[model samples]
Target: MVKLKIGILGFGYWGKKIYQALRRIPECEITVVCDKRKIPLDNKKIILTDNYKDLLRMNLDGIIIATPNETHFSLAFQFLLKGYNLFVEKPLATSFKEAEKLINLAAKRNLNLFTGHILLYHPLIDTIKKILENKKNLELKIKRTNKVSQINKSEKEIIYDLFPHDIALLLYFFKKEPKIKEIALEKSLVEAHFLIDNEIKISGVWGKGTDKERTITFFVENKKIVFDGLLSVLKLKENGNEKIIKSIDYQLPLSWELSYFLNSLKNKRIKEKIPTLKVMAVLDKIEKLL
Candidate 1:
């Protein structure tokens, strides 16, 4: 059996998770890993280096960039130019222009360019999306709160760091571009209101607090559906009664996301291209608003 040679850049918190997921795929061979700091690994066959350019020499089938947001554009661009498939951790790029360039170049070379929007691959999210389809007059409220220490670890501002997940979810759920009707920032907290397709309303709040919370609430007429990331469960409430709709299994979203990327590479197709671009464009608008 042939194995796909994969090189991963950055071995930080998220990078390590990507490595763990890629390891479980039978068809994937992690050829090289790059990081600024030394990473101790038990596998002697996998190449570990501190420089990313070394990955270029390995003739990798795909390169996953889990580096800082600022480096995503440059590293992905270089790898795409070399005609390797890419799996970039989301926001794809810091700006829409950079994201568009990478996408266009990948299309020109007939390579797969995937963004790691992990939430889209979540089992609970898929279940929620199916329940909300064809429903009108819906309202979405997502509050993503993190500890100050956790927030400090990110190189991006509060908006850039936390807003993309909810925004990506909105785009996926509504299947329409949103208009930023209002935005306000106070210290580390960011609050924004969006109108989607002139029918649905989205209110998003993200920032640093003492506690960490990841909750998504949907109001469809009199029914309410909520997905709690921390608990990995989905619930529905109506007429003052609530019930559990679904509980996710042990499978992690990162594993699902990596599997999708590998499958796309095997099939030689770029799936989710349009939705990824739409998320980037919305992020660009949000950047301009700030």
Candidate 2:
């Protein structure tokens, strides 16, 4: 098997997770890792550098950008210009214009551009989509919370840090952009209400609290399906009876997501364009509203 030479930028919280997941993929050869700070790695075969430019010269098959949100555009632009395929962490860019430019550049160069919307790769998403298909008068309520102290200091505001996952799921489930009905922001919390297809209603709450929590609930007709992300379980409720419908397999979502990216590179075909422009557009609207 020919290993794909992959380079990653950023070695912080999420970046480290990407590295760990990539290590599990047999076809991924993580050639170089770049971070501005000193990152200690036990593996001597992998090159570690504080300067990202070192990666530009490695002739890598792809580069993963897990840097700060503000730096996503600049770093991705440089890598795409070098003709390397890119997998940028979510929110693709801070602004719609920047995100569009990156997409256009990748399309022009005939290189794959992927975003790290990890939740979409979760096994439960498929089950949820199947259960909600052809359903009417649906309502989605998602709440994501992180413990205040556990939250990464480098992360942006609540909306930018947590809302992309919710918005991406909304687009995936509805297959269209939702019309923003209202937005409310507080010191540690942000909430938004959306109307999908002028019928299905969506509400999202993101905030920092004492404990980590991630839950998504779908109300379709009279049946209710809820996904408890922390527990990796799905439950169904109907006729006053609730039962666990599905418990996800042992594989982590990050591992699955990275595997998909590497396999797509090997096959030279991408299954879906995640972190789509529509996702960025909704984020733009939310940022402006806030």
Candidate 3:
């Protein structure tokens, strides 16, 4: 099988992780990496570039945009017009209108577009989904927090950063719009209580300056599934019987996501694998409520 030559834009926080995952996938070859800083390259196979423009002229099958949230629109638009398949981190665009345009452009250009909702590909999530496949009702609760000594963004923007994972999970499980009932919002923290499809109740918390925590729990019909955000462990309890469902097998989510992205590009149907627009639409609605 031929490897897909892909260029990556942004070698910062998430970008570095994506780069590592790309190297692990035999189906992908990193042809170029672009960032403002002169990022060190360990592999001679990669052509490191500080200018993103160089990527436009390179022979590439796809481009992954792992840059900051604000740059997603302009950078993604640049590559989509160049006929490259695209992958972007969560919150694909800051706003719904911009996301809509990108999705439409991908459709018009016959290119594949994927968003980095890595949690969607996680094994714990997969286990929970299979467990809940037969259940009639669902309730969702997500808690995502981090401790930051310095303020990097506004409260609302922080909310944007932390909630995309939870929002993507909601869209996958409930497939309904969530309505916010109350929000205890502050510059350093955010909490929201909402309902999905008027049936599934969800309570969410996002804040910094605390012990780092990320956990999502589901409750229904005397059964509870708990996912440890940091550990990627799953616990299931039923009728007062507690059973640890699985050991943390430790599959890198980044690798799985890249494989899915590459397969979607090869198959020419991203909708069948991961529908990013729906996730973006859910994100947009959640942002408007705040």
Candidate 3 on 151-188: residue-level lDDT in tens?
65676476557877887787786666567788776767
Candidate 2 lDDT over 1-290, as tens digits, reads 88999999999988998998899888899999999998979799999999999888888888999998889999999989989888989868888899999999998998888988888999898889898888878888888988888754322456556888888888898788888999887757777799988779889778866678899999877888899988889999999999999897535888999888888888775666444788889888888888
lDDT of 1 by residue, 1-290 (tens): 89999999999999998898888888999999999998978799999999898987778889999998888999999988888899999878888899899989998999999988888889998898888889888898988988877635332456556777888888787777889999877667778899977889889778876789999999977888999988889999998999998887545888988998998988998678247788878878887887
- Which wins on TM-score, candidate 1 or candidate 2? 1
Cα-based lDDT at residue 64, candidate 2: 93
Q: For model 2, what is the C-alpha lDDT against the true structure?
A: 0.85
Q: State candidate 1's TM-score.
A: 0.94
List candidate 1 stretches off by more than 4 Å: 153-156, 239-241
In order, candidate lDDTs are 0.85, 0.85, 0.81
TM-score to true structure, per model: 0.94, 0.92, 0.91
TM-score of candidate 3 against the unseen true structure: 0.91
| Poorly placed runs, candidate 3 (over 4 Å) | 150-152, 237-243, 272-274
Worst 10 residues of 2 by lDDT: 151-160
